[model samples]
Target: MRKYMVTAILVVFAVVTIGTYYVQASQETPPNYKLTTVQGDASLVEGIAVYGNYMIKDSTFGIKRAYITTNGTDYPDEKSAISQSLNRRPMKTQLDQWIEEHRQFMRGKTNTSGFYENEEMLAYVNATVDTKRSNDSSAKRNAKLSISVLNKQKNNTLEITSDINVDHDISDMYVQNVQLIDQQLVAMVFMNHSASGFVSEPQIIRVNLTTKEIKNEPLALPGVKSVAADGDTQYAWLANQNLEHTDQWILRISRNNHRKAYQVDVKTGQISPLTFQGHEMLLNNIMNAYGQKIYFLQKAVSSKENIGFAVISYDLVSKEYETTLKNTHIDLSENITYAFKQDHLYIMGYKNFKGNRLYVFNLTSGNLEYEGKVISTEAANQAEDEANMDLNFIDLGQF
Candidate 1:
């Protein structure tokens, strides 16, 4: 009887302990465990959206014209859009003027038979000229976005809605992005009223899909540089700098060199500071989140000396930065553009001015998955190695 009682008591205690552990585990759910599956050309995904069984692609940069495409039908067709915000002209500086002058001089000097004697030097000249042109062109902001909804189940009928127009007091204002947040789409616009000012404050336009009501309001924080939104959590990284600085280069360097990140709750409008262990200059841009981890790109302070960058992971629950990927060979500062899709981070850059190469890294294991050439050496020289400038991707839980 004594032996049996002892054995029964031990079994009961074991069951109770196991039960308590499971209850605790259930209460503290791990980061998003949803299996992420990615297909098609990951490089081409600039902005993405999912509706029922369809994936909407919003490819904006590098290309001559930005367009949206739907994958619902067998034959995908590009659709044009009308931007919700006003176009802002680029503010030119002394450096820009110098670049323009130098480019013109190069064109005149290499005008012999439409080519120069030294091919390599000619490529460098052409690349510099292209960079100047891109900088000059990006200043004049054009169309924002025009949305046409489609129902795959309903014979792919495109429902064209009346476009929303932004009220602009100045021409130097443009829409930064139109993103889907919490099943509701909103447009973020940066308005530059001061022709002499370096930085412009941001404005938010909330759109109601059902009612088509547009509410335009100034963002709570003026220093908010960029925002990364997910289904559960929405956060914006703010860079506070002296906007009164006359020179834009100085303003940008200060903004990049000194900045702080914050977590903004969309529901309660509560803001909390995000603390991490690293120099402010290291954190360049915040990429989309995977599960409960927020991933971001960090450029080293002195790129000329190190020529390296890092990938930082910040855990929401722990409120800490988990990992930093910095290798001697990984030259992230040289990258023109980057994208994080599914489980991989893609970086596009030129290899010794040879061609554009795509470097893929697996986020889960924090490993370099693959590296391959995205463009030919000749093409890279011709386009000035800015072919991958259009890289973008929609967040995992955005839709």
Candidate 2:
């Protein structure tokens, strides 16, 4: 009888342990997404903006150009649209004349070093004609904020100009990210801490272009790095760390009620805790892109030498965590990156090396698609070395 009782106890314990293991494993293993890959000529592409059938690539020369191929092998031409629009010049200027005009505009802006800062400083002016008006109704619009009109066709450029009366002090506000919400331009600005080496406190400001007013809101986290807004839902995600420690938190705010700010949505806002063991994670540099779904990137803490990337997607309607990409194959060594138009993400490291390849998760197929290789410092140096050796080689008389 004693032996039988002992045997029965052991069996039950083993069954319980196995069940626990299975539960833990199931939680960790997320469903895979479909992925695909395409190969092309090795061109370092950055800041991909897709509008209609055209894709614009912003390169090192501070110029934005697009490429299209009638035949698969050839991408032969480039044009300067961003430069022309910024200068208030006619987009149809002859090639040589446009080049000279862009050169002059760039020279004046040469002293600016910070990428985001320079872009924010440029004045944006646009003009549009209202055919419905009895007269050839043309109105000029101008503002200190960056503006782009997304029309049905998406390619036509409308013209507008106004001697934008910007409060020069607005430039003093360190604007981090800007987004268009409900046909109104919303900007997130914080304190500039690059020179100080540390951020003590951060602030968030929202500007209503239609009202021409600015509202400043205080952040709950001390070392707030970045802020992103979900225009569709009127919720803002602010990523920041504690002033004394490295712990990070994602604070969600309701734009509708600017007065009440909470860590998570009690009625509606949601907060998630993110931790980085030793390395300092700049919450500001982290990016969030929206489409049919909302996706954001956070650093994963692991015991392994190489801590990989973590991607989280939240379903707006369900109000639950839809999917997570944790410690995946995506490279995390690079400091800054952006999510591409096709829901693909890309990151470029210093000196432009092939740090890691980008793959998109296809929700329907449950697999990952190989998008393309991200330029990193390591890959760039290797390519340079090979090219230099080829140039230095002396041809043998006979091989």
Candidate 3:
């Protein structure tokens, strides 16, 4: 009888202990885990987002955002968005870095392409329309383009405003780009029909900085016709980077079932078609042009029928293949995220159980330059739960 009483008392004690632990666990929870760079140059992983579909508890999942950087990760949250607070630095976790770098000279910026900055100078373009309404009867509007330039080394500002040379209505025109080549300011724009709501092709406006004289230059695509309103043909003029220093712009004409890239000498007003040596390149595959070469991201397949991916660099002058970046180091089995900037390519391989790995390549040299990985900083006990975590790598943050 005494043994039976002892067994019953022990059972009651076990129940009470479990209930107390459960209450404590429910009251306190740990912070969310973040992904950090394990090894290699942390600069390779900077400015990219590690989107996590993390396993919260048991089979449940939660979404989390963390900005990867070399110094440390910044998890942007509600608290990190308060600007005027006492702790401003801790709260200033914005995604884009463009405004932070060019905010000083970005006044009168009408569009994204209206701003351009280099080591020596900063340039901006603004378009405005002055309307004189005669009792609102189809108001007369005058289009004006303003150029603001700041020379960093000389520490001086030059401002010029010119009336856009357009015979028709330009009230609906917008600035496409603003680039500086020595003393000339180039403003590319598109005019929309106010009545039909149609967007026309890109037009170039040249401003002689020294003379403050403005002139108009047309896009010279000799025989290529525009796509009609009700046609199946889709057309676009691909604008690219490095226009300020290159003294020329690579203009790509893309149409339905056809693609042709052109090298327009901005200074001399010369237009020529860029040649592709072997297989024809599709418009969507053309990444961007830098210097005298164009890059393409195309898929490749081997004799064994194994699928592969390729990044090709074509020399515009020679009309030949310069470099093809296909290395054995890159994982061919999983999905990859890539970004092309200047002469560098940033690639990230997706790994489900193992953390995602980063790969950086030099496009000019066609070499795999650096490698890094994404690691979890969660508790060791949560290893099983973390296996369900899904990380999707978006492109590198735009500068």
- The order by descending TM-score is 3, 1, 2
In Å, residue 185's CA in model 2 sits off its true spot by 4.5
- The deviation in Å at residue 122 for candidate 3 is 1.3
TM-score of each: 0.42, 0.34, 0.70
Question: Where is the poorest 10-residue window by lDDT in model 3?
Answer: 87-96
Error of 1 at 285 (Å): 6.3
Q: What RMSD value applies to candidate 2?
A: 25.0
Deviation in Å, model 1, residue 351 alpha carbon: 4.7
Clashes of each: 8, 27, 0
In candidate 1, which residue ranges exceed 4 Å CA deviation? 1-148, 155-169, 172-183, 194-198, 222-260, 266-270, 273-281, 284-291, 299-309, 330-337, 348-357, 373-399
Give residue 279's error in model 1 in angstroms.
Answer: 5.2
Residue-level lDDT tens digits of model 2 in 277-356 = 23223232344434334455665445363356566664444545544555444444444334333354443222222423
Q: lDDT of each prediction vs. the true structure?
A: 0.39, 0.33, 0.58
lDDT-best of 1 and 2: 1
Clashing pairs in 1: 46-392, 46-393, 82-145, 82-146, 83-144, 83-145, 88-173, 90-139
lDDT of 3 at 374: 51
